[model samples]
Target: MSTIEEIQAELRALTEQEDEINESLDALLQERGVLEDQLASLHKLMPNLGLIHNDAKQLTGMISFTSQLADNVSGKVRQLDLAKSRVLAASLRVEDVLDLKFCTEGVQTALHEESYEKAAALIHRFLSMDEAVLQLSEDAAEGSSLKQSFTTLHEAAAKLRSLTHSKFDSAVNSGDVASVERFFKIFPLLGIKEEGLTKFAKWQSAQTSTQIEV
Candidate 1:
């Protein structure tokens, strides 16, 4: 081929290469436009994402604080309940001690005065108390004051019982109908029912024998 024909063929090939390069440039520009649009969308969402992150942190902190507060409140409530129980128990113990003291003093006074009914009533009240609880109260007391009080009451009861028995027997022997009847009624209160009934029967028999003799 001649030199000019070769040059013309090379020029035609260059034109085809330029067209391909222009097409490639156009495609790259379109791709760049799409990437820019996506980047802009991401930028628009950035502030909302930041707000959500901060809100999540705040919510987590609130939950942690609420849990701690609940734990503290529950612990305080349990402590209050324990304290209340202790106070009630202490009050009951104090009341029991007071009752024991009052009964002891009242029984002694009644027995000294020869108030048999009053003494018996006090004794009955004493007997109704819970022995085990009274024992616990005595143990908690400062000294043996409670013990002494108990001993005094027991002694007074024995003395009163002996006195009633002797007086009833003496009254029956003397034929004092008033004294005999009064002591007989007091015997059941003193917890000597059978002995009182036997003594009464003997008095009736003696009275019958005297009437038969007369």
Candidate 2:
């Protein structure tokens, strides 16, 4: 019942519609291909991104450990420094005590041997030791035994000085020239050189006057 022209017109319209659908299908397939490429790229990068995350975690852990270790090392260093200071202080204290003991003993031996010069020198050294100990902190000096020993040595030195003066006077009065000369050598040791010389000169003048009268 359709005319030939009308059939041709409908057929042409159908063909155009089919062409549009085919074009749309081809565009959709191209877009799908692009999406697939993007998905593939993301899959390839996934392991590297996971590795970066793990590395970051490990780095944070390492940083934390290092901080703790540094703190421990600093504490240990402070403890060692304190220990070394204590050891050095103890050694110095011992040395000070020993020096005082040895010098006191030396003075005693010199006085016993009648080595007046040596004894005087040792006495001077003992005086210096006393001064050094006195300069220490009050608590430290109180704890030291050197304080008592210093008192004993001071008393002994005084007694020896008195005995020396008496002996020197006796020899000069007796006109014992040899004894006087021998003791004269010790006058400077006793820090009385000028006094001893003046006395000896007086004794010599008196002897000259007595001889002229004879």
Candidate 3:
């Protein structure tokens, strides 16, 4: 069995590889008409989910899995075939203890629906701790592995850290309820500024209304 550190390193590598795959496959998302036609044909022919995802879903699954692993939100990285989104999501959930597998679950016994702000904070803390672990491991290690691993971790953290502020700003400035809701939706898991976001939304809406009336 691989040690946690080894697994972490593997996850970092996967993040980089999956990022490339995502870029290439993202183009497919624009081809919905042809894709739908193909899917309908397949459905008429009697089909199950594909044994493997086309590059697009596979790319999404890989990136999702890698992101979860890097997040260290779950206790284990579950197995997943590329074609199954739920399987991919489930595997990612297992990677981070903070991931809140189901954002909506049962009673108070369940994680009592964390506010988006709260969820984002938890994710932030988990990310910080993960970074610390990687640093410590590097300090304790005596090879290229440690150096390379720490560098990878630092890069990943940089990318993830910008998530909250960017989304919050975009949503608030857009003055769209949907955007605000989207921001909140990501908040619990993103550790964003909900109060400021709300205030900004309110202010923007008021200003817009005043301008219209003027």
Q: What is the C-alpha lDDT profile of model 2 across 180-206, one tens digit per residue?
A: 776666656555668678867887888
Clashes of each: 0, 0, 14
List where candidate 3 sits over 4 angstroms from the true fold.
1-125, 128-134, 137-150, 160-168, 172-175, 185-214
Candidate 2 lDDT (Cα, whole model)?
A: 0.75
Q: Weakest 10 consecutive residues, lDDT, candidate 1?
A: 134-143
**Tens digits of per-residue lDDT for model 3 on 17-130?**
999889767767657768999989888765334534466688999999999887664433332334467676555434432232222121112223523444444445454444
Query: Which digits, one per residue and each the tens of the lDDT, describe model 1 over residues 1-214?
Result: 3699999999999999999999999999999999999999999999999999999999999999999999999999999999999899778877766776887899888877888778877766665667576677556444487777677767766777798798888988787899999888877766677988998998899899999999
The 0-to-1 C-alpha lDDT of every candidate, in the order given, reads 0.82, 0.75, 0.53
- Between candidates 2 and 3, name the one with more favorable lDDT: 2
What's the candidate order when arranged by decreasing lDDT? 1, 2, 3
Is 1 or 2 the stronger prediction by TM-score?
1
Off by more than 4 A, model 1: 1-96, 137-139, 209-214
TM-score of every prediction relative to native: 0.51, 0.45, 0.27
Q: How well does model 1 score by local distance difference test? A: 0.82
Per-model RMSD to reference: 12.1, 13.7, 42.3
The candidate that wins on TM-score is 1
Model 3: lDDT of residue 141: 36
